[model samples]
Target: MTTSKITAEDVAAGVAELVPDAAPVEVVRPLRQGRSHASWVLESSRGWLVGKVLLGPAGTAGLERLAEHRRLWQHGIAVPPVLAFTESCASVADRPLTVFEYVPGVDAEEALPALEPAVVLEVMRATGTALAALHQVPVEGFDDAASGLGTISATWNTVVTSRVEALRDAYRFVDDIPAALVKTGLDLLDSLAEEVSPVARPAVAHLDVYLPNILLDDEGRFRVLLDLEHVRWVDPAMDFVKPAMWMFPDQQSWAEAFADGYRAAGPWPACWSERMAVATGLELLTGVKYWTQVADHAMREDYLRRLRAWVRSDGADHVWSAISSAT
Candidate 1:
């Protein structure tokens, strides 16, 4: 459920248990950290790899992720091949762990601004190509058991309503939730849920597609997509919301290049772009509670500002203006 507090001794011992006589075991913290799992680099005769310790019990999510990793690899996505997966462990501080090949490439976060402009373009193009292939995967089933398989929702709207309610409930634990904010969120969720047309089954998407998760080669070409913990079968539009709302707003040319590469590999539905835009607005509004309550107070204002800006975005601008006037 969170990143573990792991030590070199624990990892070394865990590695030994996973593979007898697996030495000389060396564990080092990675330069970049993940949100839910503490990642470490493991160096041994077997090969250089990364080990992740899930802070909480693995249960269904951990096992399901291993299966999904295999499936993604089978589909030829540029993801790290998972080497070892285990839920229970006596040697690794009694936590669940997954080990995979340590990508030998530069992280996009490190290479983006410091590198030449051409390099960033290369990264975008490669990322687009991989995303195209990833989206090609057919929707096997619906609903998220976290692994993208479990109950099926006939309509995405049904799922949206449920999620909005869940987010609202989660805000109860927030330190100080103003009544007006809750009312505004509930109203937006109601209106947005009504606006979406019925959609086909969900698609396999990398729920988190930020630049940090993407790795680039020395030339700034995307090589691997990492951090595959929460990937699931969800709204196809969910995948592009980040790029459309965040990435595109920052770099117009880079976003266009990525878009061109994606379109070249396969056919995009005429409405896919519109769906993504709507999803962006909906996601922004829904996430406001989490940002304000769960996140650090320092980030609260900036997060709320982004959400307010989203109100002025494509499909949301007019609705938000009316709400503003009414209030």
Candidate 2:
């Protein structure tokens, strides 16, 4: 079935098939669509639940996400529990549909701005603690493509190089991005590729740790971490990319609070500055492409501006600087 044709009744029917014992879905409220998936909040006879439909080409990503969620849940992380899933439900055609227990809290992104400064910092600190716990989870191997939840089987430098090349190739086809900005981005990525070294060990990294994925309780404590589809086995420092780009650039105190909390758990990694810088640069390049494709000109332009500033400022250590000052 086409996405537009999907309705609350259709989703309720699909859920019944996957979870035979589930309570009848009483109400279905659509949530904002993510880059790769569409989600809905469901009120059922049992309780509240969430239904997600994988809309992207990543065929096995739903399975991979389920595995990641279970793994995190096993480690005592605050992730929503998967209730049921089907690879091809009649409601969504060939797309994957998964249901999870609904997390009851407000998204940190929307809630933080209205909160007091100290409260915001406290939330950031808690977020850092959670992320530190996430990076401590053991990963068995570099790549496990057979399970569709794999990291690349290459040295860290090689991974950076490959990502840079992929971004370069992607940027070539875009017409609006300035030629000079592209050169700066490519040159900075090349430099970063040479600077990074192999990580001591692979860890479970939630590469998308921005505010929207973070849910906070009324007390300003982190309640649930959502959207595990981008989970990967990579250098723990790589996880800082999203926050560094989206969270810390303007709010140094929040960055410091987060870094302090992370350091409280363990020694911060060596060469963290360079590693996070590289990760942020890669994200900026990828973000530009993503926003452009989605026809979000404001977001696309914002990414372009950040990319130019970051590359021109000698891989500006703003994120690292804030993090380091907390030490």
What does candidate 1's lDDT look like per residue over 73-192, in tens digits? Answer: 878899998877789777666788776777788778777888888777767777877887887887655464233455567666666666667666766766665556555655665566
Backbone clash total for model 1 is: 0
Looking at model 1, the pairs that clash are none
- Residue 144, model 1, lDDT: 46
Q: How close is candidate 2 to the true structure, as a TM-score?
A: 0.87
Each candidate's lDDT (Cα)?
A: 0.66, 0.74
Weakest 10 consecutive residues, lDDT, candidate 1? Answer: 318-327
* lDDT assessment of candidate 2: 0.74
In model 1, the runs with Cα more than 4 Å from the true position are 1-5, 19-24, 145-148, 312-314, 317-327
TM-score of each: 0.84, 0.87
